[model samples]
Target: MVSLEVVHASNARLKELGPGLVALFVGATSGIGEYTAKAFVHNAISPRVYIVGRNQDAANRIIKECETANKDGKVEFIKADVSELSEVDRVCKEIAKKEKHLNLIFQTQGNLNLRGRDESSEGLDRKMALNYYSRMRFISNLLPLLRTATTTPPHFSRSVSVLGSGGGTALDTADLDLKNTFTGSRCAGHTITMNDLMTTEFAQRESGITFSHCAPGAVKTNLARELPFWARTATKVLYQLITPLTVGQDETGARQLFMATSGIYPPSKPVEGAASASGVSPDKTIEVTKGASGSVGDGGYNLTWKGGVTNGKMLPEYRQNGVSKTVWEHTMNVFARVEKINQERGNVK
Candidate 1:
């Protein structure tokens, strides 16, 4: 594994890959998503970026900043609440109508925590709908566009979900939807697990589209506001204490961009040096890297602020339960139901 150094936002390395890329950022009105979008715009020479958010005014402000930062890049704002399926469908439809393909989709729209259970008008839990299901809805709706984008030379398209990928514990497959059982932590854990299961399923099915679920260690963003008063205060205290150790927003954005553009994590490439840009010889350990304490590896790429891929052992329980396939089928069923209902209402025509 290679150690990636953290750098300032104005570094020239970021600009090297941003030009000509078409990216859609959901939940970018604030927090890490906004910072990531700004980083891309700053580095891009002539990129077309779509900013999706609930607040039109805020979204416009972000786009203006992006334009000011990179005069050559084109920025457009799509105002919508991504938690709503109808809104997600409409936003994606507009994109399809305006652009031929999408090079990258960064799904960062999610509520950190709800003080109490809340449901959207669509009759779904607000957090679950926004954090997990809505993202999958957007991806399923836009899969064709993503595939079309990669048809040409140097085919590259990626879907990146910003969430926890390394820790899969406390994931209750029985409560995937959170209809009967729901708590702040349980909902959060389920969201991460569902994203992992769905992403891996999509990777296996859609060979051309690269999928990644990044667990951003920590970044100071407005997302902490979603927590209750006590929780928010506790989080603020911890954040202030840990900000020095956390990855900066720009570095987080660059790592995400690397995941999208870098030819790492390929399905067919011999899993040696698969993540290295230098094309060095592969490592022999079952794990990607061996630490002084022990070998550190996750079956998939578990990246740090610097873009290194490592492997780790899967829990025997999770491996034995075969949750991936179950989640896959369950998610598809939900999508099918939503599609059918939308069709009946003439929303999917």
Candidate 2:
């Protein structure tokens, strides 16, 4: 496995990698997302970025930070709640209309410590909708635009989701939607694991798109703020104990920036350096071979924070029961249903 060293966020290499690239960041109001956006803007040669968040004031602050980092790059913020399908659809449509293609989509939107299962006004579980389904919907709605942006020069557009990689022990096919199975604090854990599985399954079926599900390990972010009081206190204590081992916010951003631009991960690359030599390669690695059109193969990647690709043990289950196909069909069905509902409500333009 490639040893991923923690580098300074202002590394000069990032600037060389980011010219003319357009990236959209969702859930970047704070945490790893926010730091990554700032790092990208700072190090990119001349990047145009779109920051998505629910808070206008926070988004504007992020934009200002980006502007200060690199005066040459353009930064724009789109305010929206990514958990809502209608809002995601609207934002994606606006992006599609404005740009011919998008180079990267970073999904870091999340609220851990959700006390209970809450459904959005659009009739879906809020956590699941935001962490999984909404991201899928964004990809589906903007796929055509992504395809249009790919030219002979090979402008690769990648979709990177920040969460757990590989199947968590808690995942169950029966409770894919988490409606009837699992409850309590484990619900968030289940949601994260299921989303990882679904993301891998979906990316495998959608060739040409580079998909990566990364586990950020543990960074001190605002993620724990939503936890119940006791849980929050416990987590803080735990973080204090493990702070030395955890990655910092700026380091997380640098790793993400590398994932967004590095050609080392193309579909045709070998997996020699991708796998970890020990301990469930924190960097989940998989190789995607290119097809005749130079698009990636069906299998997506599961990566660690450091950019190493490692496979989880549960992969065989997905391949055996055809979970990949099942996930694709189910996700598309959800998108279709959501689209129909939105249209009926006159929400889609």
Note the clash tally of each candidate: 4, 10
Question: Model 2 off-target regions past 4 Å?
Answer: 4-11, 14-18, 152-154, 182-186, 198-206, 228-234, 268-299
The whole-model lDDT of each prediction reads 0.67, 0.67
* Error of model 1, residue 69, in angstroms: 2.3
- Backbone clash pairs for candidate 1 read 297-311, 297-312, 298-311, 298-312
RMSD of each: 5.2, 6.0
lDDT tens string, model 2, 20-119? 7778888888888898888878876688888898888888888888887789989888888888899998898899888887767888887776556676
Worst 10 residues of 2 by lDDT: 275-284
Collision pairs in model 2: 15-43, 204-298, 267-288, 283-304, 284-302, 284-304, 284-309, 284-310, 285-309, 285-310
TM-score of each: 0.81, 0.83
lDDT (Cα, tens digit) per residue for candidate 1, span 119-170:
7655578788888888988898899987876563234466878777655445
lDDT value for model 2 = 0.67
Error of 2 at 238 (Å): 3.4
